[model samples]
Target chain A: MSQVKTLALVTGGSRGFGVAICEQLAKKVENIDFSLYARSQQGLESTEKLIKQIKPSANVNLFVADFGDIASLQSVWSQSLKKVNFSEYQRVWLFNNHGSLGPITNVSEYVFNSFLIFIDMDQDHLSNFKEIESEITLNVTSVFVTSSLFLKEIKSVSTPIETSVINTSSLAAIQPFDTWGIYCVGKAAREMLLSVITAECKDTPNIKTLNWSPGAMGTDMNKEILVKTKDEGSKQFWEDMIKNNKLVDPNFSAGKMIDLLISNTYTSAAHIDVADA
Target chain B: MSQVKTLALVTGGSRGFGVAICEQLAKKVENIDFSLYARSQQGLESTEKLIKQIKPSANVNLFVADFGDIASLQSVWSQSLKKVNFSEYQRVWLFNNHGSLGPITNVSEYVFNSFLIFIDMDQDHLSNFKEIESEITLNVTSVFVTSSLFLKEIKSVSTPIETSVINTSSLAAIQPFDTWGIYCVGKAAREMLLSVITAECKDTPNIKTLNWSPGAMGTDMNKEILVKTKDEGSKQFWEDMIKNNKLVDPNFSAGKMIDLLISNTYTSAAHIDVADA
Candidate 1:
């Protein structure tokens, strides 16, 4: 009997939510292979150590890459996949959980009036629209490009029943946030993009796409956004106005991420809002 | 007699559709002054020539600057408006109609990806997304940031009526096109960005946003994508169809753009599809 091929690749896996995803998938899933991508080798090692602590024999590989770099992203599928035998995997799941929050200043302060700042922004953001552009490219564009690039390798594999994608979007995907303009726009686009991908792969039964809006979590992003606030300010502010009561523990969020992938409950082409679910 | 401010300020007035819009407005309205923006000094002179040809005493002034360069864009606005005397202008209309088109190829083929190219793509051509990402940037990031930048400026103006923004989008804004994925995705984001802008500015009635999709036209971008012969091609044979009366002239399309703006029939927060109109 052919060994089942079950592989999972998570971007931005070095720290925070991504690292948690690595640990959860390894501990919860059976006979799984994993590939996690991040910008630094040191960070990848930390995630690898955590995964190994959970599952001694977990087939977890680390890929060092900047998700924003086109060449690096292309390599994630081409050079990185060559190291693993995809044919042995019965299912392939990719989790794009990486992002960068751009500058907090009002964009108009510099963009339209400063030639220098505008050029610097375009160069620094990697051709992405300011806050929203970078967020979308990192969160959404990478998933689309990486999946399309490796369709050939994926199709060649016979054992995998189907390939599944779980995109980590935000509640902001549907509702626009005040300072989180780009973040909201990018997530919204991701929802539609998942719809587009599902439509493209409609004929292929083995492929599934999901737009998962992970409600607020105790992640580094939130910690940073809500810094300098006491329990009263933090708790009351989010609970009262921000409506951040749905904040889940990182491990719990990771478990939920894995559950969505493992469960056959995901109808193809569905926009799964974690809050709604 | 107080000189009335023209209802719209069109960027890239030297050639293409910008000049056409000025001509249309000049003929359609009375007592409306025009403020045109372009990068080239020669082009600005030519625009003045054309305006004078239509109406010898027409109130038209050229604001020279490169929009792609944000600082220049600012200088143009500040200097151009200085000459206008804001008290005379009641309503401000901004048409962001300038962009550059890049090559269409696989993402791997180009040294630098052109995700900004969506601002310049013709709607009919479908694109390999990875390639398009490499070539396009403006749509993913520039369009929204720039739009917001303009909105920020117009909001401060004491113009009693309202400021309306007409964003130039493509049919690809609604659906995907070949060799135009990056562009399509960018434009789609542009539409939503405007939606966000409108929603964000709901309290401020003076600011209005519209996303208009102009159908395929005989513009330079379209001409390049047209198939020399539509007959037997395995894939990418839309040009042949154009030769067989499948394509439409862009001038007629511009008429639709003008009509949308002038008719005021379309509301501020609407995403209007010209082909459907």
Candidate 2:
């Protein structure tokens, strides 16, 4: 009797909600294999260590990559996925859970008549656009391409296999948050990417796609929000959420998403938030 | 009494809908000074010629630069706007009307298992990603930054100039077009960018943003759809629309948008489609 094998890959698997996803999947899926991707080697190793502590014989591979560099993302991802013995696995999942909260500022803060000091903004504030560009690359371009490649890699596996692609989404995708313009645009674009994929992949029902809004989680991103966010209203809103201990734990949020997957209760391309489930 | 000198800038102003917008604005805006931007110098000159024919003495200046090049966009936009005597104008407008329809193919067509010949797609087809990337920059990034810079340039105008920034939007921004994933993403992102700006710019009553979905129009892009589009369903959809003459004329659609601006009937940051009016 032959048993089916399972494989999972998680982007941004080095920290926060990504780490939560890695841990939860390891505990829930029987004899699961993982390929983790992140920018930091140390964070990837540490996440691997935590996984190993749970299951000593677990197969976990770490890929370190900066999402901003297109060449690096394409090369590292292609090489790692090329090595997968896809025929041996009956189930595969790609968790596109990695992304950053791009500059938390009003869209207009990027504007101004510098010489006229139109809004008490810096004359050369457009320089701040570099970070915005890098953030866009990580959140939009890389995510779209990564998911595209995931579909590409799975198409070649002759063996009958089920594939699920999940994107970590946010409330900001649907609701406009003050000063969260770039972040909002990125989430909305990512969600639409999955929606388009679902529409295009009906001819291939074996392939699944989802946009899971993880909700407000206690992560490094939240910590950063507390310090450097420029929008006082958004900043205060987060502060109150933190002060009231209203933030969802990363593990809890991740577990809910995994349950949705396990139960197969989600419609493909649905943007189901944690609050919904 | 100092007379109010009205100024208008139209991006993608070389041809099609862009040309329509220039002609309509010059006809309607009461001796409006024109600044036109497009990648083609010849196209810009033609647009200028059309504007000059409409209003023999119209102040038409042409700036030619590729939207995909950041340095060129910055330098050209800045130098052109700097030459403007903002104080002399009581009204300013920017028509962010340029974009492209990128890769009208199913999202899965981008996928494949090369070794197994999983999908009968080209092995190196991801190279098509270059077009998608360029299209996104033209549609989303350039639009966002251009609107931002417009806000910046007008901001320094010490005079109380009533400013309007309009993004030429599409039904695709709110609806999914099968096989038009990249184009849909760009429209959605652009629309949301304006929404966030509207939300953020509440304090600056002088600045207003509008997204006008022009509906389907006879254009070079539509012509391309009949020839190169890979999705039969989408291609047929456009083909039928063309054959039936159900498509909106560029002049008519652009004229309606100009009416919205002239009437000041739209809520700032509101997405108003031609059908609605």
Candidate 3:
């Protein structure tokens, strides 16, 4: 009989921290299975290729879905389940890593005659209602829905498997970021959701939930912050971090995260700042 | 010719803190036009009657609408604008007072074999997916949509009016409430939204925003907490407050809110705890 595998479900696993995480896991664990979900097929394929190159015998499946849309997420989730039966897995690790930075414009620059011109700007453009909604959907609502669905599926399994949800969070989750209004709100909501879930699942021995902030990383997100931000102060800060090599490497952060997960040292619903760890 | 009236748009103004706010504003300000929105027409009528009893000449208009429904909110907002043109008022005070106390059970009692059973419970019951969504809609989404619409209206006005959004917040915004997961998340989002808006409107002297925590109040919400909660600790805490008369009176809190609004002493985007005020 084939040995049952430990399944890992990762959202936004196409590139950046997601790809780094998959790479680190492939190096550390043998005979592990991966189901990576992302919006870009090309990115997903690239990530899969890299993982396969690292571990020749690894089984890597890619699912295309936009976290911003509920129907798409639901469809992708169901398809993923069909590909990998929950009962066959000894353990399940869910990594919620997908998020968007949305429009990064200075609040001060948007002022016209003491009024925020962007507030009434066209929705088709950046920093409008559409962008704000998209940010919230991708960052907050998607995490909430995906985690809830995963928990439900775990509950339905005939043979219970050890499961844990690691939510990708940021300093923005606790601190208010200027010009990143919707994003900050979304991150804060994400942390609160994880905290609440942790509290709710206190007695469930097989389930664990944690919010993990990977700190500032030299990823596409950081690049976007450096390139897209109109705020001089914010731009300078990012530029300085990049120049001084202050940003954390995605591989290092991923390694730390995997170490924490495998050790199961944090049994409670606590936030783990990877930088501190 | 009648002097133009300063208009106040209050959501969830049928009862509780909403009614008290309307009552106090009527008592303090003369020629203040009030537009109260709530789901219960009967409750709105009763509130209007109370306002008139305090200030017989108060122009109190009741608009029946559910804040949770977007269509209903939009229709009511437009109807309110038609009733009193935005140009007619020198100032507008938007009191976002609507919220729901979602699933007030204690986290301590929910442990099952060292895990929470409610995490996988049916959605039809209490503290499920449906209830969580409802709480978010009423508390967070409603505030976002209403404030956005209000800002849009202010932008369109040919004659600018000094407008401010006073979001009725709670300690729950800063502190996590175990069983009130959705409610706590919603409140936190509300505060972040207010902070973002404040940053956006830093240059706009005509627009101001604040998240005001009215402290513990003896209202219908308090009654609900006392009656709906199954957690012994939470029950005892609230009961003790009631027994010791520690809860602030709704009218007194409302009076302080009106004082702050008129004085406009708080210009920054900071949370106002009534007890501190």
Best by TM-score: 2
Candidates ranked by TM-score, best first? 2, 3, 1
- Docking model 1 quality class: incorrect
Question: What does candidate 1's lDDT look like per residue over A35-73, in tens digits?
Answer: 888888999998889888877877878888766666557
Model 1, TM vs. native: 0.77
Question: Isolated chain A: TM-score per model?
Answer: 0.81, 0.92, 0.89
Clashing pairs in 2: A112-B152, A156-B113
Taking all chains together, each candidate's TM-score versus the true structure is 0.77, 0.92, 0.78
Better model by TM-score: candidate 1 vs candidate 3: 3
Give per-residue CA lDDT, model 2, range A1-277, as digits (tens).
Answer: 0264778899999999999998998787776889999999999999999999887777999999878776678768878888788887888889998888766666655643455455654333445344566667788878766777777667767755788889999988877776778888988888888888887788778888888999898999899777757666767988999999999999999998888887776788888989988
lDDT digits (tens) for residues A182-220 of candidate 3: 677877887787677776676677788777888899999
Which sections of candidate 3 miss by over 4 Å? Answer: A1-6, A71-91, A103-135, A153-163, A204-208, A216-248, A263-275, B1-6, B71-91, B103-135, B152-163, B204-207, B215-248, B262-267
lDDT tens readout by residue for model 1, B1-277: 1344455677767776667667776665555667787778798788778777876766777777665444345445666655655556666677766654443422222222245346535332334445444333434554554565566566556655556777777766666433343455566666666666666666676667777666655565666554321223412455555667755555566677677666667776576766777
Please say which candidate is ahead in lDDT: 2 or 3: 2
On DockQ, the leading prediction is 2
Better of 1 and 2 by TM-score: 2
